[model samples]
Target: MTESGTLYVVATPIGNLGDITQRAISTLQLVDAIAAEDTRHTVGLLRHLGISKPLLAVHEHNEQQSAQGLIKRLQAGESIALVTDAGTPAVSDPGALVVQGVRQAGLAVVPIPGVSAVITALSAAGIVQPGFYFEGFLPASGSQRRKRLEILKTLPTTLVFYEAPHRIVECVTDLAAVLGGHRQLTLARELTKTFETIHTCGLAEAVAWLQADPNQQRGEFVLLVHADVQEKAEGLDDETLRILQRLLQELPLKQAVALATDITGQKKNELYEAALAFKAANTHE
Candidate 1:
């Protein structure tokens, strides 16, 4: 009876080869076998590092068969490593099925975190929204993608999605319609590459910016949009802060807070505190 072996879930660089971590490099070199999403794509990475090993294709199409062979290799006392074409495997990539199979076969799955597009985009976006949701990439066709957006419409946090250049315009339009035109958005393209560009504006303005740039129609992009700003509030009060900001021009702090709270459904104490702070700051200036 052979005891099962360990499977390393290693994360590769999204674009830059320098992004590979020391641990990931060491693991890939030390593993008995590496199951790659694309052996041809991974060959370049291996050659760059001067490390050579057996490569197996384990993408969505062949994951089942690949997992069986990999499990047998593990049972034979071989350590295996999994690498996607880019970034971390199983993150909108193709290592999930193999990982799930490894677990079912009673093998250990250890993650080797390094570079990822999702993390890279989020960090450089300069968006300090309370939190954000990563919805990955939407479906390429049919009502499936629209259905996803309908659910995305209700989230109160920032929305982030990965998109291809060809579909970028359609994605922006759909997002604007579902999330509203006034929603603040940032479109980051070719991240970490030589021609990286970040465009920040409302939904409509983002679409316009894309149109203005004839060359921006190429490369991958990460789309981020504010989910909080809305014209009409469902349960919470609408325009409380804006009303308070407006009334401060005419009324005193106390009066403005009272009026704003009355007009909107916001809590009186919260509105009063915010109003007081706003008034104090303005008065000081």
Candidate 2:
């Protein structure tokens, strides 16, 4: 019986061809064939590297079906390299199903990691928060996106999101509305490309900044929302605290805070802080 071949999950440059890693190039050259998110896009990268291999179209539309075929190839002792149009595969991108399927079949799946848009943006963001929540792309629906943001609003860690150029203006508007205009936001646009721009400002100012220059709204964006630090809850009276805690038991933290604000006429930020404290106290017990 022939030994099963390895499946390499390689990360390519997000932009700037020079960013491609030596190991990634070597793996691509060595693989029997490559499974690409977009064959037309991957062909350019492969051509640039002077590597030739059979290209298979394994995209979101046919990932599950493609996975089975890939497994059969690996079983036939044909090594394969999986790559997305840019950055790593299976991360806010296709190839996840293929990787999962290959693994379940007991085939070896190796990672040749390199450039990632998320890590690249966060590296230069200058955010002091110790950790981050990578929310990736939010729902395209405005109402659904806002609902998700509401739940994430009070998080004490940095929030990382990916946004498309066309929806950037509207996305920023919703962000300011739900996450608060006062919070700091870092916009990393067209990363690693010729027109790359990284700017930081308050959420309220993000929309204006993007609109003032049309070019600014023309590329992929990585938005970094600064962490929310809970303020002192000393101003809350016993009645308000009681009300907030009671609401917390039956509602999400953001909802609890909002209802408490209406009931006690306390500031929303203050009520949010109190709600976090109450939840933390309960968690430790």
Query: Which candidate number has the best TM-score?
Result: 2
Most lDDT-accurate candidate: 2
List clashing residue pairs in candidate 2. none
In model 1, what are the clashing residue pairs, if there are any? Answer: none
Name the regions of candidate 1 deviating beyond 4 angstroms: 1-4, 231-285
Q: In model 2, state the lDDT of residue 39.
A: 95
Residue 213 of model 2: what lDDT? 98
For each candidate, give its TM-score against the true structure: 0.79, 0.81
lDDT of 1 at 22: 93
Compared with the true structure, what per-residue lDDT tens digits does model 1 show for residues 1-285?
A: 111388899999877788899999999878888999999999999999999999988998888888899988887888888999888999888888888988998878889998878778777766655578898899887367777899888887788899999888888888877777656677888876778887666575677888898789789888887554442333334345556666776787778878887888688877776655444323210
| RMSD (CA, Å), each prediction | 6.5, 9.2
Badly placed stretches (over 4 Å) of model 2 are 1-4, 230-285
Tens digits of per-residue lDDT, candidate 2, 157-218, equal 78999999989999999998998764568899999999999987667778999999999999
> Residue 17 in model 2: shift from native, Å?
0.5
**Which 10-residue span in candidate 2 carries the lowest summed lDDT?**
276-285
